[model samples]
Target: MTDAVDRAPAHVAASAVLRVGGRELDLARRFAVMAIVNRTPDSFYDRGRTDALDAAVRAGAAAFEAGADLVDVGGVKFAPGPPVPVDEEIERVVPVVRELAPLGPVSVDTFHPEVAVAAIDAGASVVNDTTGIHDPRMADVVADSDAAIVVAHSLAAPRTQLPLPHYDDVVGEVAAFLRERVALAEEHGIPRERIVVDPGHDLNKNTLQTLELTRRLDELGDLGLPLLVALSNKDFVGESLGRDRDDRVAGSLAAAVYCALHGARIVRVHNVRESVDALRMVEAILGWRQPVRLRHNLRPEGNG
Candidate 1:
């Protein structure tokens, strides 16, 4: 059997650009940033607030102007803990979607099918499913709406408690899993051009597993779809650098920078300001995002 992990992802199977309102997410461009808009308290990134819709609106707009080509809004906040009810998720995210989708190309990060439908009705253009479409109804929602989807590979639960860490080869397992799900989505009527893959960083796998995935991140590009990296300031980033959650800004930017170099296109981070500046520097040095794809050496010659 050809292990999907051993194989490399060429491009995310996305052939067409995701047109959100007036913004065109041209995936052919090297990479882009999708600012995190958490309208819930329990998000793993611990971002924006659900109660304060107006403030959250401001945050979304600011992210758009701050070099964010897309804004991802999450109402249910999936972390390593209990899941919120579908009704609560809808109530929290729908209003934000209704308000922000008009403002920009907004994506809703959710797992519940009901929540997905509500978000779509509220004008969300994308559905980011971290579960890899475990719920059958999830595909139905996406199929009915015909929205762009992000199918990330996850295990155990959205929050972190697990039976135990288990993977023969961590990176290989994740890549294979995502590939299978991508196929599964196709089976369920979702076209290849509308999907993106994410190697779930902190949702299911342990710190070591995440590091392995990051080390071989380019492997995902073989899928031939535009890649999206949610390399925000998470617990694993802290574990690696011996830093705490509050101090993972540099680590988050470092992880995102690494992902970008490895062919991932969209980086999801909490500290948008820092991530933006770092990617700008990346564009300046690497020239990947430049008009000519600059090809400058971010590192000096012979540094290796």
Candidate 2:
């Protein structure tokens, strides 16, 4: 079986691109980057953006300008915590969603059904719910629109204080969960063309689980939807690199690029420029017809 590079002259990627609203994301080849612009004060990353809407807007603009095809704007963190109310969640995210939705393809990163409805009603083109359609109303909220839904497989709600959960087969379970939710979305009048799958990397995963997921990416590809991989600065990277969140830019870029090269179609990231650059290099390498020659192999074309 020949890979994408071997079938060059423009091989169509296994990935599919869907138009959320006015903007169109390039999901062909390796998945394009969807940079995160967290609009929350307590998010694991970019916490300050929530305190000021202007900063959040600026960050969104920068993410787009830097090469993110879509800016994922979310006000809440999926960490272990209490459930946030609908009104408060709306208050935290709406302004940024409104401001950034016009710039490009804007996706609201939320799990609340009301939040999803309001965000799309405002200007967001895609509803990126991390709950895998666990909320009863989430499926119906965007049932009629062209807006896309991401069925992210998170083990439990963000606030659940369960002991470190163990999955005998994490990838299999995640794929099953996402597939089930996709069915649920279809039942609620959502089109198959508008569904994407996300294996919730940090929601309930440890370092080993996350790393294993990356290695076993093909396990989730069977769902036959665009795969969005968010590998920004989570605790795994911190532990691996012995660096704090702020210092995980390099690590995040590495993971994002690695995932894309391996078949991920939508890389949700933070350092948009760095991730784009890394993927470009990977594409050039895997995409090349032949390897580059060193200077020592300086035979003339005729002499060879």
Candidate 3:
């Protein structure tokens, strides 16, 4: 029997385009910056910075203005805590999704099928499931709508703490998990084009595993789906540089650039402007994107 990787086509087509809601994203021509807008008070990064409805909306709008290709509106903290009922989760996110949808393409970060349905009804174009579709019904909701789905590889359920997860070969295991989840999504009627895969850095793995996944991200490209990497202020980068959350911007950007070079098409980030700049630079270097202007150091003829 052929290995799954071996069976995958040698060269997947480039110039990929993904349509989400009314927006068209050229995955091959440019890297997408997905800004995180959290509505939970206990979120790992902001710690309730945008917990209020108005604040969340403003945050989403600001991210769009800062060159975010998409904004991920999340209501619940990923770490274990008090249970946030589905109704409350929907209450926290749907309003923000409704208000932000008109600004640009919006993605709702959720693992609940009910919340996914409500957000899609309120105008979200993508469902960012960090649980790797533990709730299989979420796939059905995504399938019934025109939204794209982000299938992240996490070893445990959402908000649940686990003993340090172990993997024999982190990259191979991640790729296999993603392939399985992607297949599950397709089985539920989500087209391959509308499915994105994420390796779930730091979600269930340690810093070393996260770094290994980053180093071997290209292995996931064989899945023939666009890759979305959530490396924004993650613990791996912070731990690697001995920096705290606030000081992890440089490290995060470095990791994001590395992922982009290794075939990640979308980077979910906190610092939208810096992430956009870094990604655009990488795209320019790879010849996928062009510089804004070329006259910086070129002297006019007969002037030099």
The models' CA-based lDDT, in order, is: 0.75, 0.77, 0.88
RMSD of candidates 1 onward, in order: 7.1, 4.4, 5.2
- Residue-by-residue lDDT tens digits, candidate 1, 162-247: 76678898878888888888888788887776778888886677888888888888877777776777768887899999987778
For model 2, residues 120-178, the per-residue Cα lDDT tens digits are: 98898889988788786888887866688888888676557446868898888888888
**Using Cα atoms with residue i matched to residue i, what is each candidate's TM-score against the true structure?**
0.85, 0.87, 0.93
lDDT of 3 by residue, 1-304 (tens): 1343243223222437776865668785578999999999888999999999999999999999999999999999888887899999999999999999999999999999999999999999999999999988999999999999999989876788878799999999998898888888989999877888889989899999999999888888788778889999989999999999999999999999888778788999999999999988766665655579877779877886
**Which sequence of candidate numbers ranks them by TM-score, best first?**
3, 2, 1
lDDT value for model 1 = 0.75
- Whose TM-score is higher: candidate 1's or candidate 2's? 2
What is the TM-score of candidate 2?
0.87
Q: Look at candidate 3 and give me any clashing residue pairs.
A: none
Please give the ranking of all candidate structures by lDDT, highest first, separated by commas.
3, 2, 1
Where model 3 places Cα greater than 4 Å from the true spot, the runs are 1-15, 299-304
Task: Please state the error at residue 72 of candidate 3 in Å.
Answer: 0.3
- Clash counts per candidate, in order, are 19, 1, 0
